[model samples]
Target chain A: DVKVTQSSRYLVKRTGEKVFLECVQDMDHENMFWYRQDPGLGLRLIYFSYDVKMKEKGDIPEGYSVSREKKERFSLILESASTNQTSMYLCASSSPSEAFFGQGTRLTVV
Target chain B: DQQVKQNSPSLSVQEGRISILNCDYTNSMFDYFLWYKKYPAEGPTFLISISSIKDKNEDGRFTVFLNKSAKHLSLHIVPSQPGDSAVYFCAASDIVSGNQFYFGTGTSLTVIP
Candidate 1:
């Protein structure tokens, strides 16, 4: 089955620490996205990569960055973890039809 | 501002009843719209999608209706079961604009048995 796998299901980090969330897709989709889901804000896109090494800022990319070094993997990086950055982060890869998501990584920055 | 909006935060329905989740978007350039179902602690999964060319699309128990003129879309679940209870999200994207997909706030649906 086609799959998008997230490296960690849950994480807790100290404030000011650099954090990394890894995602990999076996479907070879060209489009990969990173989003954080908050209560009332829903899923706000942080960053996305359309091709290897090509990234674009999304609606809420201020506190996050992404790396797409290889075709099957996309990584979300938090330069410095903060309490406000604690949220459910989701990774997705898409083709022309639809997007497939990873199980998600719930990160807690304290 | 949120380009896509799901006004309802939550909805409850009895078993074997119809459940309707609504979404509206401000972008007219969006040519593809989709619905996703998410359970607690899980990533949202693709449910159904409707292209701008078609007004409606059905897949078994789920159907998505799109009205381009109004920039509105709705998902209908007939005879919703308890297993159907989950958070639903609506998303829209215009391939011409880019590969980015805009999502709504989401509606949490509960189907009581």
Candidate 2:
């Protein structure tokens, strides 16, 4: 079994605050993804990394950035948190055929 | 435009019965389809998958059927259990982008015991 771990399960921050979400996978997969899930809208990709120190913007990448300094760790940074950014964040990793996901982090901005 | 769509937002079924969830895709280039199951506050988990070369694939109680002509797919869970109640998402991808995928909004399934 593969384990993808997120730094926080739940978080609350005030507007204009900077937030960082961390994800680590034990399986050493080549691809990593960050997504924000909203009701009725589904999971929208925010960022994805194919290798260490390489990142690509997904469909909804505004106000967000990512860092991947090592093979097992990927991080998502919210430069300035806002109410609209409050949603469930998910982390996923994949090789070529299958993808695995972390438990997820629920973020709230007020 | 939503390329992949799961029209039904929710479905309910009785235990020991079969639950069918449908998904449709408008892109003809999609060569691989996958199903993911998500629980509350958790990331989606891979459930089953089907490649374009095959029309049907089965694993345990979950089976996925793909129709290339219609660009449609369905997941059938036979003898559904209460534990199977969750949000199911349909995803599609092509080989051009190294398996980059597009996901549907998802359908919520509830199994009553």
Candidate 3:
């Protein structure tokens, strides 16, 4: 079975605190993506990595960054948590046909 | 600007009835399209996909229809069950543009039992 695991199911952080959301996929897929889902905005891509040690910004990458040091692991970083950053974060690994997603992480910033 | 868009924010359908979700894209470079179903607090799951080369693809009760000339696509769910209630997102990708998937705003679907 294809599996993508996210580190946290829910998290709460204070403003100015740094946050890290980790994801790992057993499929060893070449592409990994981090996205945040908002109520009306849908799923907007934050960052994506096509290969290890490589990262590309998505539509909304203002307050976030990503790292992919290893092939199976991709990490999303919140430089400093802010109230506007509170949302559900999703991670996905994609092959040529489809992308398998992790459960998701709901982050609340206060 | 949103390259892909789901104009409908919500749709309520009775059980055993057909549910249709629509999506439109502005970019002509997009050659591949996909539909994903998402539940509350869960990540979206792949439902179906269609390529530009093909106009339609079916899997079980889900069928995706693509109209290249209109830059539109729709997903049809036959005999939708209550379990089918969720948000549906349409995504598009341009193979030439790093194959990064672009998603629409999403349509919330509710199948009443």
Candidate 4:
């Protein structure tokens, strides 16, 4: 089984604060994704990386950036946290077929 | 524009009854479709999937039917259980497009015992 682990289960940050959410996958999958899920908004992609140094912007990448310095780790960075950014963050790793997800991190920005 | 759409925000079904969740997509280029189930505080898990080449796929009590002509798909759960109550999200991917997925909002289903 594949394991995707997030750094935090819950977090609270003040407005304008910078936040980092880390995700690591034990499996050596080539693809990793970052998504934010909101009520009635479902899962919106933030960023995705196909290789250690290759990154692609998803539909909703505003106020966010990503790093994939290594094959097993992907990080989401919020330059300036805002209330609108408060939502559930999910990380997933996959090959060409199915993807496995992390437990998720609930971020609250006041 | 939202390529994938799940119009029903919620659905209710009695125990042992059938639960049907619908999803529609506007993009004809989508070649692969997937359904995910999500519980509170948990990330969405893969439920089932169907490729454009097939119209239906069944696993136990869960069945997924796809209509390529209509650009729609539906998930049917038989003998619905309380454990089945959760949010179901529909997603589509264009295999030619690096398998990039476009997800619908989601539909929350509640099973009443």
| Candidate 3 lDDT by residue in tens digits, A1-110 | 99999999999999999999999999979999999999989999999999999998899999998999999999999999999999999999988667889999999999
Chain A TM-score compared with the true chain A, each model in order: 0.98, 0.98, 0.98, 0.98
List, residue by residue over B55-91, the lDDT tens digit for candidate 1: 9999999999999999999999998999999999999
Each candidate: how many clashes?
A: 0, 0, 0, 0
Candidate 3 or 2, higher TM-score: 3
- Runs off by more than 4 Å, candidate 2: none
Residue pairs of candidate 1 with colliding backbone atoms: none
Models ranked on TM-score: 1, 3, 4, 2
Stretch of 10 with least lDDT, candidate 1 chain A:
A57-66
Q: What TM-score, to 2 decimals, does candidate 4 have?
A: 0.96
Residue pairs of candidate 2 with colliding backbone atoms? none
TM-score of 1: 0.97
Every candidate's DockQ is 0.76, 0.65, 0.69, 0.72
Regions of candidate 4 where Cα sits further than 4 Å from its true position: none
Question: What is the lDDT of every predicted structure here?
Answer: 0.94, 0.93, 0.95, 0.93
Best by DockQ: 1
TM-score: which candidate is best? Answer: 1
Candidate ranking (DockQ, best to worst): 1, 4, 3, 2
Tens digit of lDDT per residue, candidate 2, span A1-110?
78999999999999999999999999988789999999888889999999899999998999999999999999999999999999999998886667788999999999
Worst 10 residues of 2 chain B by lDDT: B93-102
